[model samples]
Target: MPTLLKKGLALMLCWFVSSDLYALVILQYHHIDTETPFSTSTSPDRFTEHLALIEASGARVVRLEDAITRVAKLETENEIGPGPDAPAGNEAFQVAITFDDAFISIFRTVFPLLKARGWPFTIFVAPDLVETSAQYLTWDHLREMQRAGATIANHSLGHEHLLRLKGRQTDDDWMKRVSDNTREAERQLTMQLGGNRPLLYALPYGEYQPLIIERLHEMGYTIFGQQSGATSRSYETPKVHPRFPMGGPYSALESFRTKLSSRPLPIPHRLLDPLLGHAETRPSLSLHLPQSLTRTHRINCFGPSGALTIEPVGEGQYLIQTPAMLPTGRSRYNCTLKASDGRYYWYSQMWMRKLANNTWWEEP
Candidate 1:
């Protein structure tokens, strides 16, 4: 979109903003087939229903890179000054739909659906898998999608877990290899697409430690994670933007609506926990939330194992912990506050717990 048109559209969105900040919901999926792994696949029929719901909600379906740029601008404007910039009521939502791993189902099913509607979307692909695996997307499919308003971005070469070290690999070697993988993936995307592609990367299986995130940041990339939350002031700006999964059991229409209605909680600063835990799988999390929310006592934090107890420590800092240890692999601590309106202000901290030997238990 042109700069003039983009600004005009932003003015016309008329969203329900919280704390003078605009929000964008990024929804991600892997497969669009019923035959693929159920945990990572949304059937074609369910996906169609999801699109119908999105259209009904009157939300703007934008390409991935454009969504981030819009949010960045909104955040900057709100930070500088605040006023009647955002309306005091309901309006259309802003959502960016993305598919990860570039499965054939996306090229076959998802492409035609969105193409017919002439709506824009994004696909995060591991270039190494293109045409190499029958289940994955081919370069021709990518070219076709790219021609039809789809933004192709990096998902790392080989789609391997960045957190898990290979056999006999040293810590330094692993970090270097991971960084290389990311850079090479982006290079391949540019080589294949032959356009001014952005350095957008989605973590393979959404696995990353603080170190991995920092390395990617140093490389000048905007990272996307599989954590469930809205993108707004809550996100770490251009780094590690959280995305809601839209597959498997999470494919329910009501659940999707609730996520679309969600707002970013007030966590602009003071969350710096490295979500990598080994021995202490049941790790503790601390957050510095607004005192006004603590006073309301309506803020609730939950982990996948169970509801976590939010203990107020001091000076607007709260200790969040769950009784049950998270199962090996990825999990999240989700905090939500019911807003004056019916919708909830939400934030999620993604965690990855390795096995006792500090090795990932399962492959993505």
Candidate 2:
């Protein structure tokens, strides 16, 4: 073989050998404009800075589905997008860019930036909002995006809270209702975009029950939740992934760089405690040190208020306790430890509780 060909083969071998170790850090955005709600908006200027920083970080920007396949171990790389001519992707962490809600700013601003770099992205569209509102993207805009190598996937028909149920509805009744909406939203994408888009769903308001996940899994949909983590092969949920929210002040480049480079904390499948509880309920999160981890002295677990209590039980087990009862609504117990590589291994456990009257609380 020629010298270049020989180098190519060697790189290919390296990719295959280390493929299992790859991690995906998916960045989730809702609106890329300054005018929308700040809680869900990143300024267009900040988004441009984000793109520059992403390029500087040296992380591979991949399509969401392709990243999922690699990190979830769903398919060999050959089955996804890389070819022999493609750079061997084993060394750098992969990042996927996703915009929820199909906002017009994404079409006006984000699409061109991504397209110029030849990077692929996924847009989770809520069909009911599109074309009906001035803020949201239209069907024609979606089709244009699809033609320009973007994925327009399902965010549900109306973007309603799938977990919220009517007073008289059973869980079975709720599932049927939400599932029908999901299916119809997908149908709209197929009809409008004229392609078989992947079955990817983002939970609205970042709320989910175990039953909701079970049903969506049965429906053959891969889920992305509004949470924080570096999704890895060791993720507890194979089909459901967590995404780092990139909106409001959190879109600042400093926080962005930290999360962009963070590693996934090792967690097992099927964590049964507090991922919610009753209002004002204190929840305990128990976990063990990763097998490769040694010297647990630098470990830190943070809660909504401040630093949490981490008690080391016998063996490698430890229990993290919150300092106070979490306020009603959604919260995350984020634990981080500095690894030998100087990057933090991050794990976020979501907790949610309804108001005293059983009404939902708005995110503050």
Candidate 3:
């Protein structure tokens, strides 16, 4: 009887943990060179080691497009069976590998390594950079990589930040910019490769306003962000997908290991919602907990000021009744749940005002 009771407890804990497990990692890379200011560039040897580590860990390397498709299928309002390529079991984890900026080294070095391992990756390219022999990927090299099983996606024409430019010349300026860039890239790629035009785009520098995102969507491009988080069925948003940037000075193999092994960290409340203002009105969030822990579990909603204790309403769901209305300015907030089983989960998001106009705008 004692052994039976222990097994029951273990099963209960597993259920509790699995109930909230929703995350998928997406790793992003740019150049893999060895130059100053580009120290984040992975040497060919280090790159090989990285691939070996991923292989040994038994992690699946998916393309960015595949990742998007999986998340979209999972986010469907009503779906019975698993979408294409999803694991038979719902608990399986997935990781996607993506490269941005269409670096020459990616074609020469990364492509060969991935081909040998039979791995899939997505490369976001700036069409203008192709065949220039000017510090960017050439069309010939890109075609070779694509033939080797890599998917090439759009990253705009000049790789410029699409946000932060506004006013008089904005509308005409941005429409031309977006159209010319996207069309030229699409035309060149189609003429050369005879494949479907890439419908996905990565925001340069991960900076974009709501207007910019809307414009990209209007242009038939699914937007991707450089935010640090994990993708999942629950957290599916076309305009703000998560990506882990892998080309920073502080990013080492150990760091990569930690990223691969650990789950996505929750966004801190302070960073999401600042204490100085009221900015939570735009996107109000609530936590719904399972009924298993009616008496012992509590939900804590944290902000820049401090923790806001939320009282349980029903089952495991908690209601946060703010003392003051959320401000109109930009803000962010984080949520944490301390369960009776001694485990917790964290999440955060930023809330900001939408743009006034719907017209296209450029980053000048």
The model with the greatest TM-score is: 1
Error of 2 at 348 (Å): 0.7
Rank order (by TM-score, best first): 1, 2, 3
Candidate 2 residue runs with Cα over 4 Å from true position? 1-20, 74-92, 234-239, 271-280, 294-297, 362-364
Top candidate (lDDT): 1
lDDT for predicted candidate 2 compared with the true structure = 0.75
Q: Which candidate, 1 or 3, has the higher lDDT?
A: 1
Question: What are the runs in model 3 whose C-alpha is more than 4 Å off?
Answer: 1-22, 77-91, 164-167, 170-180, 234-237, 261-364
TM-score of 1: 0.86
Candidate 1 segments exceeding 4 Å error: 1-20, 78-92, 165-173, 233-238, 270-277
Q: Please, what are the lDDT tens digits per residue for candidate 1 over residues 1-364?
A: 8999997765443232333346678999999999999989898999999999889878888777777776666655654322222332332258889999889998889988998888898899998888887898888899988987889998999888776654488867887998888878877888888858877889888877777777787787778888888776523433578799987998888888888867666564433445465877677777876555556547789888778988888966888988887877778899987765566667888777777778667666
Model 3 over residues 1-364: C-alpha lDDT tens digits? Answer: 6999998886554343342234466778887777624534666676677788888767677776776666566445423332212232333356778888887788778887888888888888877777666567887787878887788887777776454344457676876676666677677667776676458778776665665666667776766666555555432333556566777553578766645543333221121221122223334455554444334444557644466546666666566544444434333455644433233433444444332333333322
List, residue by residue over 116-229, the lDDT tens digit for candidate 2: 999999998888889987988899999888989888888888888776753479877988987888888888778888757877888877677777777777787888788787
lDDT of candidates 1 onward, in order: 0.76, 0.75, 0.59
TM-score for predicted model 2 compared with the true structure? 0.86
TM-score: which is higher, 1 or 3? 1
Instruction: Report the Cα lDDT for candidate 3.
Output: 0.59
Q: Count residue pairs with overlapping backbones in model 1.
A: 0
